[model samples]
Target chain A: MYKLELKRLIKSRSTLFLAAAMLGMSVFFACVTVAGAGSMESRGYITLRGMEAIEYQRGLFAEVEGYVTTERLEEMSDYSVWARDTYGRADNMPRDVYERWISYEPILSGSCGRMSCEADEYYAERRAALARLAPSEAAIASALALNWRVDEPFYWEYGFGGSEAGVNWTLCLFALCLFCTVIAVPAFSQGYSCGADGILRCARLGRGKLARAKILAVYSVCGALYLLSAALFCAVILLTFGPDGSSAQLKLGAFVLLDMSMTGVLALCVLSGLITMLASVSFTLWLSSLLPNGVHVLALSAVMLALPSFVNAYMSYPACDWLRLLLPTGSTGLQIGMYNELAAYRFLTLGPAAIWTPFAALAVPALEAPAFALLARRAYVRHEGA
Target chain B: MNIEIQNLTKKFGKKTAVDSVSLTLTPGVWGLIGANGAGKTTLMRMLVGILTPTSGRVLCDGADTREMGEAWRDMLGYLPQSFGYYPEFSVADYLDYMAALKGLEKKAARRKIAELCEILSLTRVYKNKIKKLSGGTQRRVGIAQAMLNDPRVLILDEPTSGLDPGERVRFRNLLSEFARGRIVLISTHIVSDVEYIAAENAVMKAGRIIDAGTTAELLRAVEGRVFTARIPERELERAESAVRVVSLKNEGGGETLVRYVAEGPLLPGSDFAEPRLEDLYLWLFRDERRQDDV
Candidate 1:
């Protein structure tokens, strides 16, 4: 039975295609990791000169009225009015930048400081659900960026509209899904695509044992690739951009959350990979059993898998919004932002600006695994023969 | 134990494929000869539980095959006219899979695979992918897999269709050896192949077994309905229209030797003669509705 399953798996066109795809993706993943790590330093982000330098500059001034001196207050007041006036400006030096530059002092800002950041755990769940385009993904998702190479930190905090970091994060997700789907589509179509049904159907316990083996083998093959790609990309982004919050920063917006344990993100990858594999295999199995030709299985499964993504195209449409929530790709349609509740900003409370990441990722796979298992059995044994 | 077909009937929508067909087949090689669309494949498929008959009892050693799942199929082996398998797999891998499906334990499976491969001369190509093998070799592989379990009953449909002469003889010899104490119903359109191997020949035409018996017995039954006539080539068509023309051979100008079927003489010297298997098949198949047999 083992031999039969192995033979059936080996003979399958989908399996071979998946193997080749994994190898290529693994290499691409490694490159993405390397590039991300290598380029992390030069990425778009600004680091404050230093608290020491700013503090030294502040020391030169005299203080009064439990605030700064009257003159220092005047200087701070001058900048505050300019920021307020140009709040909606889109200039290179927009108020958004000015806002970040002149945050309040811990005691004087009237907002919570490091002490407030301590309670950030309250909003952490929502923050962890952030989804945005990773810079690496956005860098390649568009045709204008045709010459743009894949970079590191392949994933972003939010999968859709936010800051430059947020947009890239969301786009990156769309890109990765497109890539992962190539592998998943073939895995599902393998049985019919390869014409190995006879061997599978004839084996002892062929209906039951061979199917389990197939699902395992396909998942193992695809999972290995996904891991290699994800790990390599993360390494590249992290290594290239030093560990400072700016380089490969993982900030979340207010309510959309991700991993509090950090392990959640990694678990997400492994889990999604397994789910995609089962869904693909099961769908393919169903197609092979029902359709006379494997091409139909491949074409139809690809369409069915991809059709759900159209919901993300129209952001403002209410129906599209609902559709996106139901789409398998919707979770990744988020954006992440950092709400600095701290004075020096050593820590950031992460959140998705307007999306749900953790939940969507988990839900997509939950719907796919069992569906594929049933389909695989049908495909492996359904007969049109005498 | 024997499989009894009790007035078994199969209807395809409205057209009956097998109608009121009853027979008792025990352990031996039974040759089923019929023309195209004669319900040969349908009958065989039903016997092995692949196709369901409209109303029939496919008993396996007294057990209904439909009612009994694994227990019935455990003893059944079938090879359809066209069978497909994964082409990239080596013959051994495919057989192992078949073994698993047949519920054979690993040890027994290995032993059976080896034995069948040896019998079918598949040992040389046992490790080769099926796609790379020749047509005849592939057919043998199908046969080998069918026999892997040493099944109590085997239904082989057109088993020798793709085989070369030597392989066919070898297959026939092998089947005969195994059929000594097992039921093997081999379906074929060709009469000669089974004429030599079958203990009993079953003739089917228009979805019914018009005649069945030992080779000599069937030949004797059709003796008087068959005859040969030499006449002008143009007039031969007339004789053909009047009688079932089995064969035609041109002897000279405007003259042809024609063998045909008749209830009595159509021409002055058109006497009845001995009938071959082909003649019987034609006489039965010539007109399905016309059952004017003497």
Candidate 2:
């Protein structure tokens, strides 16, 4: 049955198309990650603007300039003369004197070391100094940088950069499984919705064997998708960023990405995929059983995913939280969070309606889910033969 | 072990597709003949437990199919109209997969797949993708999958629809070969497909079984009403208005041969003839136009 399911899945156009599309996307994402291009990272594009600021800072001595002092001139506190000497390579200068005058503050504090630095370094030091004066602005800027994971591109680019392909892979599998469930509606639902396959199933061994086969086939498709997606995500992440990136690593993007392990991120991705895919498949199966049309399942899933966010946004407080919780999309947040190794610490509290609910409401005769059982039963009953 | 339906009724909203239809049968080829909206398909689906009938019982080998669980399905085979497939899978792969779904053990499934492939003439295209197969071959694939478990009961709705003459003959022969110890319930618009294999036939209309007997018995019921006549195209409408015209053939030179059903007294120019299942079927279903069913 397993082998047969594999072959059958390979035969289906939608599944095949899904796999192909995933492969193509993985390859593209892998190549992009390999290129080490930062444009794809996130909300910010650092370019010629920083260079303009660098050029302007050259005119300042104590122009209250932003440039960090790379070096200083002793006799003349004029950085213009020092800049000329340094261009000739701040060569063999007196380290103590150079350091003292550059950090010196003419109005308030005594100067410290360091006169000139490169554009990035200059900005870094300037922020540090300004932080001493006004902590709010400096703190906000730093927080923003940390949020975007931009501090270290080596970690972000290498670690999470390559992870895009894998994420896409996992996402595609969820999509494929969702697709199989919905598609089965048209093929399997009629067995009962139209009652076409009943005669054959009843007269022969089809009552059990045929049903088992359909289930086996469905899961086989799901398993294949899951395995493939996992492999793709892992492979892309490894090749681009190196396998070690799955652990804690620095990253650079809009802001600076600080401490995070690669393992935690992968765990999150897998958990998200699992929750979404399972929910999708189950919903599809259930819908196929009841509805003659399969589109209803897809639509239901879409609404499930979208409604909670919409309601949470408009209602201010949770309006249909229970109803939303009934949906896979709503339930997935807890599922994903709990499954993730890093984020597993998140605690959950079930509200009033949830507390008194009977476990039987969640229990189904087979697979314990309406979608899975409905589809399987429908497919079995609707078997067409002769 | 056989199939038995007791007081089985299925409804959709206010309309009934099958109303308290019941029957008991052992293994053999049984032909279900019906008008377009007869409850044949509906009754078949209910028996298989796919569609839960509003009220009644469907039993297979004393095991009520509704609660038969998964075991009963293992021995059943089905082929619906317009079946679909992955298209990417090779013929062999598709068959093998279906064989597994039928619950065949690996070793047995493999052997069964080979046997069915050869039986269905699918061996040559075993490596070919289903999408690449011709319509006839696709239908053949459908038949083979139904036979994977050597099901005790088989239901085929319009199985020979797209076959060429040669393929149809072969398919009919194949069906006859497998009829032993198995109940083959077939419903088709084409009478000829079941003519050679069916031991008994049924005529259905308006969710009811109006006739059930041997083919000869059914044809005998309508014999006195049949006649063949050649008339000018201009008289076609007049002749049609007089009785139920079952078939019309162009005889060239603007002349036509019209075969029709009438209760008594063939017109002087027309000739009396034996009835056919096709003619009987048309007469039964065309009752709406006939305005009276006795």
Most DockQ-accurate candidate: 1
Residue-wise lDDT of candidate 1 within B146-184, one digit each (tens)? 888888888898899889888888888998899988989
Worst 10 residues of 1 chain B by lDDT: B285-294
Q: Compose the digit string of candidate 2's lDDT tens values, residues A1-386.
A: 43454455466666677667655654555454444323211112222222232222222222432222323212224553454466443333354433333323221111222313332243354345433422244444444444354222222112342234333443344344445444444434545443334433443344545555555566556656666665675676564445434213221111112344455545545554554456555655555545554466567755654553465345433234344445554433221221221221111124322121111112211233445655556644554332
**By summed lDDT, which 10 consecutive residues of candidate 1 chain A come out lowest?**
A340-349
Candidate 1 per-residue lDDT over residues A84-187, each given as its tens digit = 57653323344344433243221112211211332223223212222122222232122123212312221222110112222332334334444444444433
Worst 10 residues of 2 chain B by lDDT: B285-294
User: After aligning candidate 1 to the native by TM-score, how far in Å is the CA of B148 from where it should be?
Assistant: 1.3
Candidate achieving the largest TM-score: 1
Q: Residue B97's C-alpha lDDT in candidate 2?
A: 58
After superposing candidate 2 on the true structure, give the runs of residues whose Cα lies further than 4 Å from its correct spot: A10-327, A330-386, B69-71, B106-120, B228-236, B247-259, B269-272, B289-294
Instruction: Please provide, for model 2 over B46-128, each residue's C-alpha lDDT reduced to its tens digit, 9 standing for 90 to 100.
Output: 65555677898978888887676666676678776665554455777666656655656779978888888887788898888
